[model samples]
Target: MALRMNVQARLDHRFAATYNRFMAAAERRWAYESRGQLLSGLTGRVLEVGAGTGVNIPHYKNADHVVLVEPWPAMRSQLHQKVARDARVATTVVDAVVEDLPFPGASFDAVVCTFVLCSVEDSYAALAEIQRVLRPGGTLAFLEHVRGGWLASRVQDLLTPVIRRFAAGCHPNRDTEGDIERAGFTVLQSETLKPLPVVPWFAPFVKGAASPADHP
Candidate 1:
């Protein structure tokens, strides 16, 4: 896993450009499925993780503050451009990894992540960071693609080894919800949605949050 993480960190830019292009198509699908779901997912001081190109800016509601954390430099540049053209992106944007957030503990009301975790080397570590920065009980809303059941996992296992070498370490069979659970977060609500093109079982991500009950 550490080696795989290194591979992803190394190929960040090459993947960023391609990822940015396909994002529009993915967002179109997400819009059909999530629509106001993304909007409803956001509230109060928010932090959108791996906020690639800021596709979520328009989906967020009015808030006192909003922060976007994206590490890929190429994507960060594009994210800046996306923000410049928008009027509501009057908040801060940081080019940083989620594993090392630049905020204090319990600083936000919600954390938003959309279509960004598929490539994270350590999704669990990133989730821990999200949990750390968010105020107790603060919601962590996200849209992510993860490993499907048996057959899909078997296929992903075969293709993943090949894909990572060329596709920027993106995994097609990561059990995202399970990883989130291992990261110490409760799954509030979730579902299996439509599939993506080329890649089977990858589309219209499940939306869920992780906050402890009566969180300390």
Candidate 2:
């Protein structure tokens, strides 16, 4: 059991690291402008989940401080390097997952999640945690890939099993926008964009912001 767990952990780390390197160029090609736009209006202390390679680090101008939560050690190592070299703002990198956050209720002014919900073990739980840690009327900004049209959706469903085995457990077909609404957040705004023409499985993206319906 221990050996299997260790091997899986290593595999997960290696896959995440490789994915970051592979996607770095694609992100530049397909998501450069949108990345900055997605993070345009954030303010106060913020929490960002799955800060892969700290790609969004350069785009964060409004936040006073950013607390990055990344569970994968390999990604966190790269994140640390980026944070060290970044002199623009304050950043704290924590080795933690989104489903279970280590902050108090109403601790953050906003939460940011980009291209991360598809891989979380429990998307609902992660959103609940995001809701809990945010201040009343705080923002939840996200940019995620969702299920596409019928043909694309079918392809996503077919490839999900094999993709999960090697692609850091990412689900190609997820109704992430609906999941966000169902998590008791009032959808403020949302827009869909197309990914690169070749990767149909990763096409049909959504970028939006939401706020919790109420706070206790």
Candidate 3:
């Protein structure tokens, strides 16, 4: 079991190192636009969880300061490189997981998550942390691929085991929207889309903003 865990960690490291290259085509096709829309108008101190390779860095136009949280070493290395190259936004990279964020309560003005909640060990725990760190009336912006139609959902379920091993723990059929709502966030605006025509199983993408139900 220990040996198997080590091998899985090694595979995850490799996936982190090459994640940007694997998603480059998809980013150009539709992800960039979707990310820009999700992050638009966000300002003040912002926190982005699971900021893989800093793909959303260039789209941040109004943020005063950005904190990027990535737990994986290889992914953080690439994220640091991206931050170094981009001077448009003031940014800091922190090594932390979503479930256990090392920050004070109500520390950030806005929190962002892009393709993150799907892969977390505990989605509810992660969301709780996100809510704890966000100030009153603060926004939570997200872009996630979620469970789709009947056939697509079955395909996601069948492939998740293999995909989770090699794709850095991604579960393509998560009901992330429902998870967010259940975590006390009131959906402000949301849109669902089938971004990848070739990848039917990757459909039903959800992008939107929400605020804490009690605060809002």
Candidate 4:
């Protein structure tokens, strides 16, 4: 079990090193635009959970300060390099996971999550933490690839085991949108899109904003 854990950690670190390169084409095609749309107009203190490699850094134009959280050491290394070069927004990098955000309740006015929910050890718990840290009436802006259609979902299910091993814990078959609703966030605006045409299993991405149901 120790050996297995070590191997998995190495795999995760390798994935982190190449993550940005792997997603560059997808970012150019649609991800950048989607991020801009979802993250635009954000203000006050903002927290971005599972902020892999800081891809959303440039899009945070209107935010007063941005706190980025990434669990993997390699990913945080890359994220730090990007944050160092970016002067648009005041930023801080934290080594943490979404399911266990180390902060006080109602601390942030907005929370951003992109391409993260599908991989968390417990999506519901992560969402609960996200809700806990958000101020009343705070927004949760997210963009994620979720479970696809019947056939695609089945394919995703079949591939998930292998995919998770190599893709840094990503589960392609997760019903993330439904999970969000079940987590008590009222969907304000959502759109389903096919961002990566070549990756059929990664189709049907969901981008949207939500607020805590109790707050609204």
lDDT of 2: 0.86
Compared with the true structure, what per-residue lDDT tens digits does model 2 show for residues 54-153? 8888877888999999988788888999888862678899988898888999999989999899988789999999999999999999999888899999
RMSD of each: 3.6, 1.9, 1.1, 1.1
Consecutive 10-residue window with the lowest summed lDDT within model 4: 194-203
Error of 1 at 115 (Å): 2.2
Per-candidate count of clashing residue pairs (backbone under 3 Å): 2, 0, 0, 0
Decide which is better by TM-score, 2 or 4: 4
By lDDT, highest first, what's the ranking? Answer: 3, 4, 2, 1
| Backbone clashes (count) for model 2 | 0
Per-residue alpha-carbon lDDT of candidate 1 for residues 1-216, written as tens digits (9 for 90 to 100): 999778767676677777756556756765434735655446689888888776677666576678888887887888888877763735778978888998999999988776667677788788888888888888877667777667777887778777766665566677777887777777787766655463564633566666744472
lDDT of candidate 3 over 100-192, digit per residue (tens) = 999999999999999999889889999999999999999999999898788989999998888889988988888899999999999999998
Flag regions of model 1 displaced more than 4 Å.
1-11, 31-36, 87-89, 195-198, 201-204, 213-216
Q: Report lDDT (CA) for all predictions.
A: 0.72, 0.86, 0.90, 0.90
lDDT for position 20 in model 4: 83
Model 3 C-alpha lDDT versus the unseen true structure: 0.90
All candidates: TM-score: 0.84, 0.93, 0.96, 0.96
**Ten residues in a row with the worst lDDT in model 3?**
194-203
Whichever of 2 and 4 has more lDDT, that candidate is: 4
Which of the two candidates, 1 or 3, achieves a greater lDDT against the reference?
A: 3
Say which prediction, candidate 1 or candidate 4, comes out ahead on lDDT.
4
